[model samples]
Target chain A: MKVPNILKKTVPVAVGLVVLGYLTLYFVINQTPQWIPENLTRLARQADLLENPEAKRCFECHKEIYAAWKKSRHAIAWVSETYIEDSENRSKEKCLPCHIPRQVKNGEKPQPRLDHRDDGIYCVPCHVIDGKMHGPYDLFSPPHPTQKNLQYRESKFCGSCHEKTFEEWKIAGVEDTCQSCHMARTESRLVQKPVLSWLHSKKQVGDHSFPHGEITQEDLAVTGEISGKEFIVTLLNQKIPHRVPTADNGDPRLYLYVRFLDDSGQEVDRFKEILAPQQDTALLYGKEARFQYPLTAPVRKVEISLQYKPAWSKDKSEWRQLSYPVTGDSG
Target chain B: MRTSLINSLLFTLMLFLIPLQLQAKDMVVKAPPESLGKYYPPESKEPKWIQQMHKMSGNLGGVFVNLREKDWDNLDKNADQFVESYKEASEMVPEWEEYFDLKAAKEFAAAAKTHDGEKIGKAVGAVGKTCGKCHADNSISVWTRFHWPSFHKIKITDPIEEKELDFGKYMGLLSGTFKGVTVNFKEGQYDRSQKALRAFKSRFMELKSTCSKCHTTDDVKLFYVGENVAQAFDGLQKELTAEKPNPGNFWKNVGILGKQGCKNCHLTHRSYAMIQERWEEK
Candidate 1:
């Protein structure tokens, strides 16, 4: 096989040009200002506009985080039926700030966004501070500028909206910060999409579901017994950090029902005890609640149950049972 | 023509190099330290007292199963063996002896002698409660190290309510049940202890269900240290319902439940914390 001089000269020249061209492109992408959508740029430029469309812009690059955030309670903070109902059909001015805050500033109460109200607690509200996106790490995000802020990594960041919970946490004196329990991280590569994954590194992604409401049956121990003509029911709050039925505005309630059954298994007597945030019966974390009822007649069996009502409702909604029935014999 | 081809090749090459130049450095950030302490008990050969404890647990389970099966002879045999093992362990760890109720053992033996299923079952439950109480008081710190990390890993959305699972409250339930079992047992309120134990078992099962969502069924079963512990409870239930319960064997089964059931799982999964620690170091 004979090799031509012209062909050999051209091959090296082509390879060298290709390498040099690629290097130029890379430098330009890394160093040049990231391209921003016109609408977001307009929003970011405005001083009075609290709601910035920049969050949607963020979604273009951070697709996975956006997807997770979309499902979180924060995403629906403005649209939830319960919140709307509790906030007097979204007319409550004070409540709107926390639910649809523009941005969280250190030691300052957040203000509601001027627009994009439906995007409650959107990405820009927490991530954007004075035109820069802040996060726990200062990673290279070519699409947007990022700054590392230690506050974003602390519980105080959550305290902006969850003031009462933060106070409760402080008084409880546990070492765990809000992120430790709520935003637990697992070892994995951060991005889910293939193209972007190549650019990103392995790190912990905060679970955006923000687990709440699923109660461990054992955490709240309820026991009942009839002793000396008195039916005694004891409720213990062993592990919850805040009150058993805790919330900023929701009126959660705990109900104890005691029913006495005769020889035929028919209910002969019924006694009810109610614990609510408004009724001064709310059980604090690591506290106990005891209710006693005077027995009027001899009964074959006494059945006791504990139920939880998330909030007060005008409709006759059945409350969820906290645990299985505890039955005791009545002599 | 040659000049044009060379220009085209240069253009193609430049485009390929863009990604290389723009590629971000793979960040290697340290994960935040875990808030709670990772308990690592001093490593040493199995102590004599621990071996006795295992025997006692196995005897407790044996008594329960034999009683349920109406094997009176084995039940009596296990119950006697458990009593002796309990005494031996108690003598070795006298400080922990106050937590054990020898009177309950004697009563269980008396019930076994009568071959009365109901009486024997109650006695066996009492003995089991005593064991649960002691474990809850003394062994909880060690046992929790294996299971607590799992709680952090669990995340699920409720289908009905469409809300996130309250992991904090769930943890509260676990710790509460763990605490309740001990407190009730220490008070000699076997009935309350039994209920608490049942609650603990139920919660543990519920928590274990989440494991399968992310893990294979076999992996979950293998990693779950509670399988044998649950089996021990089943043994207790059988003896509790048997027509003629044997106290001796029931007690022995309980000993196995404590020693092999709980201890084995802890030993197998002890590396979980160490692995987590290594990650932290990285």
Candidate 2:
């Protein structure tokens, strides 16, 4: 065969470009899309709630989702002991709206729902509007009266109440929406209330738990070392694209506890630093919160731990812990 | 003649005393007179009592309309026809025959022949009062006793144990299994709770077959064992058996299961079924 030099060279180059382009497309598409603060449509007060729909009514069909949401903090937000004490047994009306929020539209801060305060950011408030149930998809829920509102996919919809966290997320320029992490999507029938449920096709349904942090070892990078008289630990928000201990008006605190032990696992001395958004000590996106502690005489080892109080909780719970033994040596 | 009069007095006194004793003592729900059975199911293909009542009603209406038109011949015929039906219906129930105003009915018929509107009106009023009095005394009793379908014959094949069970026994078994879950869960017996929940889930799902048999209406069937109740059953079972089960959550889920899975159906059918069962037992 006659060798066509130009054709051979061009064909190889074209094939190379095609392969490279394919790889680029694959990687780029999988990367999380940056959070764009949507100019969400006003969940305007089109009408009052439909006869104060009970949470259990929503549960009749959304049983699985209800089960998940039932254990979530949102379910007991209004009834939580901390919330009650903090609000002075509901004497402070200003602290109420977000706890028992009304229709969560991107408008002014929502007013508290008058009755059914125990429901606390339930299905009807988030999904129902103006006598019609609104959601992310248009489904054939006959006689049920539903409208498709795509804004549920937007970050601004959640921003209506999570005002500060949404702002932090937007500033982080992460390629993910609040729904991406918190309201993780799974393919399932939207309404599982049967007979009617049989007719539905699988769709992306968000976790109704509005889940808390999915903190993993990789999400918060913890590294520790010890010097002659100082033990310095650096905790970085490596993977989570939002600030740690983030909330609107929440006081969830991340306490870094540094303890010195006399080689017997008995704490001899302890020091604490509160990392919270209000205190500007929260670990931010691609940022680190460092805690450097002094090792006194008779201290043979150091124990480091992070305990956290949830958004509406007053009780401290163990977040995570790690230990380092610098017995007569720096580790 | 003296003996006959004494017997009549004794029978009248007995009727009043019998009712009073029944009220003061056991206080059982009053069943309609046994003669009323001739109007209901198993004795008749349809409600013969209701049919006969409707027929008499129609005839009365015809008589009134004929009277209004001043059609003497038709009014006279209408009155005779009404009297005939009234007499026949009164005789249909042996005990009810005595309560019929047979003389008043005949008087109305006679008044229609006279073509005196005032006399006919008086006779009609007299007959109408008899009908109203009987209805006022007995209508609700008739409806309560015979109108609703009795749970007497509904035999459910309980799916869990795979055995034949009468409606009441089946209901007891189902509820007992559910109650086991509650009792055991409260006592921190998770294994027993899970077992009872498993049995309950099967029985509950199988109930749909029986429900669909009678509840042809989709909504009614849905109310008892539809997708919501089915899902609630399944979700409850899953939660009770989950690896990191939240005991409080399982309790909450059980409450939901009771509402949708048990209480809603009981609200619609239980009290009525209970009354029917009691009636049958007696």
Model 1: CA > 4 A from native: A1-51, A188-196, A311-331, B1-282
How would you encode candidate 2's per-residue C-alpha lDDT over B19-63 as one tens digit per residue? 433333433445688877866654543578888888877766666
Error of 1 at A314 (Å): 8.3
lDDT against the true structure, each candidate:
0.59, 0.70
Which candidate number has the best lDDT? 2
lDDT, candidate 1, A209-301, per-residue tens: 565545565667777766687878788877666667655555565666778777787777766655544333567777778877656565777
State the lDDT of candidate 2 residue by residue for A142-239, as single tens digits.
43556779888888888887777888888888789988888898998766776446545577778888788657888888888875567888999987
DockQ numbers for every candidate?
A: 0.01, 0.01
- Model 2's CAPRI class? incorrect
